[model samples]
Structure formats: C-alpha cells, structure tokens
Target: MPSSDDEATADSQHSTPPKKKRKVEDPKDFPSELLSFLSHAVFSNRTLACFAIYTTKEKAALLYKKIMEKYSVTFISRHNSYNHN
Candidate 1:
C-alpha cells in the first residue's frame, strides 16, 4: 500500500498539465518598405475608415484588381464607402 504522501504525488502526476504560453508575433519585425506606401484614417463614426496606398497608377490598378478578384464586389463596395484626402 502506498503512503498518503506517495498517493498525493501520484495524483498530482496524473492531473492536467499546465497550458503553454502563446507566442505573439511582433509587428516591428515586418518589413517597413512593404507598408511604407500605405496610409489610413479612421472616422469618429467607428464604422467608417479609409486606406490609401501611395504608388504608381499601374501598381494601384494591379492591387485593386487583385483585391477585387479575392473579395466580392458587394463586400468591397459596402466597406469602401468612405474616402479621405
């Protein structure tokens, strides 16, 4: 027969293990040049916002095409009602 102390140790060993800590990705580690062209503004309404990417017209067209291809036209239009100069 195991002692009470031994039984306690055995019970602890069989119990649930501690959860592992989650690793958060650092935004500073991302390349600066990739985001350098982008600018954003948020409206007081909270639902309204806009993003402007500073690049050549050709690149802008290409990016818009890619976004449109991936997302639905209605979805894009609904969320893109706001513009900031």
Candidate 2:
C-alpha cells in the first residue's frame, strides 16, 4: 500500500505550474539580427580583431582589400592582425 507522504508528493507534483515558453527574436526583421550584432558586438567595442579562414592567402587578401576600401577607419594598422597560424 502507498504511504500518505507518497500521495501528498504526487498531488504537489501535478499542481506545479508549467514552465513559460521562451520567445525567440526573429532575424528577418530589419534592423536585422545581423545588423543588431554588428552594432553591439563590433561598433560598440573601440578595439576589434577579425579573423578569416581561407584556402589561400589570395582569398584572404581579396577581403582585406575590400575592407580597406570601405572601412579603412576601423582597420587596425598591425601586421600581427593578419598573421598566419
């Protein structure tokens, strides 16, 4: 036979409230999630380091040229920033 304590415990378990569902932010809306992250994670920080994974130096150089052309102000003038691992 079940004890009185077991019955009380089972009753309390059933009475417990269900956890509220978490609402995830949609990325499709602009200023988009990409923009949101760029603003906070990149722009907010005065000092920033970027890394690129490429098959060859040529590929990395392509992006480096574009970044220099567009956002030269944000560029860190350090050879170490683009060091090979």
Candidate 3:
C-alpha cells in the first residue's frame, strides 16, 4: 500500500478546482458589467463583500450615468429634466 502522505498527495491532485470569483475591475480601469451588477445588488439589500480598493465611487457613478444615458432609464429620474424636452 502507498504511504499516507502519498495518498494525500494523490487526493489533492484529484481535488476539484476552486470556484472562480467575479472580477470587478479591468486593466483599463473602465467600468465593466461586473461593477454595474454589484451596484445594482445594493438595491437588493443583500450583504456584499467588495474589494474595490483601486476603484472609486465616482467611477461607478459615472458608469451608472453612462448606462442611464444609453438606456434612458434612470433610477433617479426626478433631477434629470433634460429628458423632459
């Protein structure tokens, strides 16, 4: 029979791969869909663990602004009277 350490090594080699976590940032530092998803998750009142040390709130807000402009669906539409005309 193989040694206990050998069996352990074989087991480790056959172990399932770790789950991939979602990435929020990109190389260009531009706002991506993942970031937008996380921002929307805030509305769900769910606990979220974010590791966005490099990204700032301003960037996320800018992303949301871009999204709103593209889709014309504003979550806070009261102040955006420009759409009225």
Candidate 4:
C-alpha cells in the first residue's frame, strides 16, 4: 500500500501541466529603440554615418527578405555619403 505522502505526490504531479517556453528575440535581429539611440549618438557626431537609416518595420522586412533569399550567406553594408563640414 502507498503511504499518504506517496499519494499526495502522485496527485500533485497529475494536477500541474508542463510549462511552454517562450521564444526570445535577438538584439541584432532588427532595429530596436536601442539601435535607434545608438544610431543617433554615432551619426550625430558625423553626418556621413547617417547615409542610410532604417525604421523598425523596414528592418523587419529586410530581415524577412534576407531569410527568404537564402540562408547560405548574408552580408550587410553600411554606407554613409553625407559630408558634414
């Protein structure tokens, strides 16, 4: 015969369900507010670094396109044509 403690353990185990893990987002995956702040800080110093700036939505789209194009290799280029005198 099972003891009272064994019975309690069995009941508890059956009452609770396993928890599902949540997916985490990567920092470099897209343009977050932090990215914007960094962009502002760095580009503010030199206008040339602000040649191309992408919004969060634009960054998401770019990420999707990059994924669909091919996962073999990915290359991101940063070009700044601004001339601050």
Candidate 1 lDDT over residue span 1-85, tens digit each: 8899999999999999999999954444334544665444433655333444344445767777787897554543212222332
Per-residue C-alpha lDDT of model 3 across residues 1-85, encoded as one tens digit per residue = 8999999999999999999998855446434543654543344666444423233545667765665676544243212212221
Q: What would the TM-scores of all predictions be?
A: 0.28, 0.24, 0.28, 0.26
Model 3, CA-based lDDT? 0.53
Best by lDDT: 1
Residue lDDT tens for model 4, 13-64? 8896878988855445443433555533333444342223343554756765
Sort all candidates by lDDT, best to worst: 1, 3, 2, 4
Q: Candidate 4: lDDT of 37?
A: 50
Q: How much does candidate 3 score in TM-score?
A: 0.28
| Candidate 1 Cα deviation (angstroms), residue 43 | 28
For every candidate in turn, the CA RMSD to the true structure comes to 11.7, 16.6, 12.6, 14.0
Worst 10 residues of 3 by lDDT: 76-85
Q: Least lDDT summed over 10 consecutive residues: which range in candidate 2?
A: 76-85
Clash pairs, model 4 backbone = none
| Clash pairs, model 1 backbone | none
lDDT value for model 4: 0.52
| Predicted structure 4: clash tally | 0
